[model samples]
Target: MPQLDHGANALVGVMAAFGRFELQQELSGLTAVQAWNLLSPFLPLSQTDPMAFTELLCHGVTPAGGFAAYGASRALAELVGLSFDTPAAQAVLDGGIAFLREAGVPPMRVRPYEWDRWLDTGGNVESWLPVRPPPPPERPGITPLRPAETRLVAKLGAEQDSNRVFISRDGTDFVAIVDARYSDEDPTRARWVWHRASTLYLLYLQVGRSLQTPPHWVAAELEAYVPLPAPRF
Candidate 1:
């Protein structure tokens, strides 16, 4: 799509290439009306000049454009593949919702259906969006995925390098989960760890078996390390 010339509106395609921080900074402190001011000229509402039409379409935003600024801000998310919320972009949106929530936007008198859709098809998008996931199970030695402060600092092998691993924050608290499976599955997943980046240079001085991240080859080297189970009683 061609770029428009209306301030940020002209940079619609540019938004696609921008990282989360750039996008967040692009829309940090704008009110709902002000934000859409950049969007309106390209909207159907603006029939006179429909230049940057694709901008409105990129984020799965429909013709409705309900929550205006919030909707447009959300439309800044990464919509390429799997469509997970990018950290920086999500931060700005969550801040706006937090402000409204503190203002007591939803009174207790309001029923669930008043906010949620009737059919329960996972589309209960109210003024706030990206329905929050339920809390994870509580367990010791593993920090709960809450507080929004959790960050992956180090992914260390669990005791014995087993199916489980310790994903820690700043080398301190950690949560145990199935290994790189935290990123992807076994057969379908293609993993390339940083074995050749930092410590790998020291641990493996020469280019040989020791200088590699394991499980890359199926039969070339895997057959040499298979351990049979102990005889059962």
Candidate 2:
């Protein structure tokens, strides 16, 4: 049996960011598109699935999470030149993110995925805009809206966008959803942020925001993650 409590959190964290809900899929049971469609409601956008997300997380027919965790540990151990991954266990201290810790592991730092030193400067929205903003609303209009109406609507026009993040027009962007425990809700209350992101962004958060792996990271899956078949473990 695979111990989800041991090393599965990292895989869950990564896939969940991309709104991948079918984390339990097995390579032997489901096709890529089947798993993708199974997770359809969890995604915030009807737009095409992220180009590399499913690929990076899923190598073959399904996600095969159990195997993925084994792979994560294998990758981490190889990277650190160790037989096990405890030495590279991640932690969080002071409000900032911490990668591998040399001391007793502390709690994980859960920040908005986009948190950075720039936030330490106490910058406002205007400070980080890639483009200029329009002047204050000339009239009372809450026409603008978030990409999803799943959450409660406090305002109609300008007041509506608060529940979501906005990206520039004609530019590429990614939304990483996190802290979403509401997998079964009609409209999940998972926290999501739309930020300018890249591959570096993923690595940056992956390293900095980790802490001790939970004794057991819950398996959110539709496929049986059986480990009895793998040759290495």
Give the TM-scores of the predictions, in the order they appear: 0.20, 0.17
Tens-digit per-residue lDDT, 48-127, candidate 2: 33222223223321233333333332232222323221212211111112111112122232223323332554643334
Q: Which stretches of candidate 1 lie over 4 Å from their true place?
A: 1-3, 6-28, 31-33, 43-56, 59-70, 73-120, 123-233
CA lDDT, every prediction?
Answer: 0.30, 0.28
Q: TM-score of model 2 relative to the true fold?
A: 0.17
Give candidate 2 regions above 4 Å deviation.
1-103, 107-171, 179-188, 194-196, 200-233
Candidate 1 per-residue lDDT, tens place, 106-205, comes to 3221234323321233423243322222122231122233433522322333333323222222233323222344332443322333222222122122
Residue 41 lDDT in model 1? Answer: 43
Local lDDT at 81 for model 2: 25
Error of 2 at 134 (Å): 40
Error of 1 at 118 (Å): 9.1
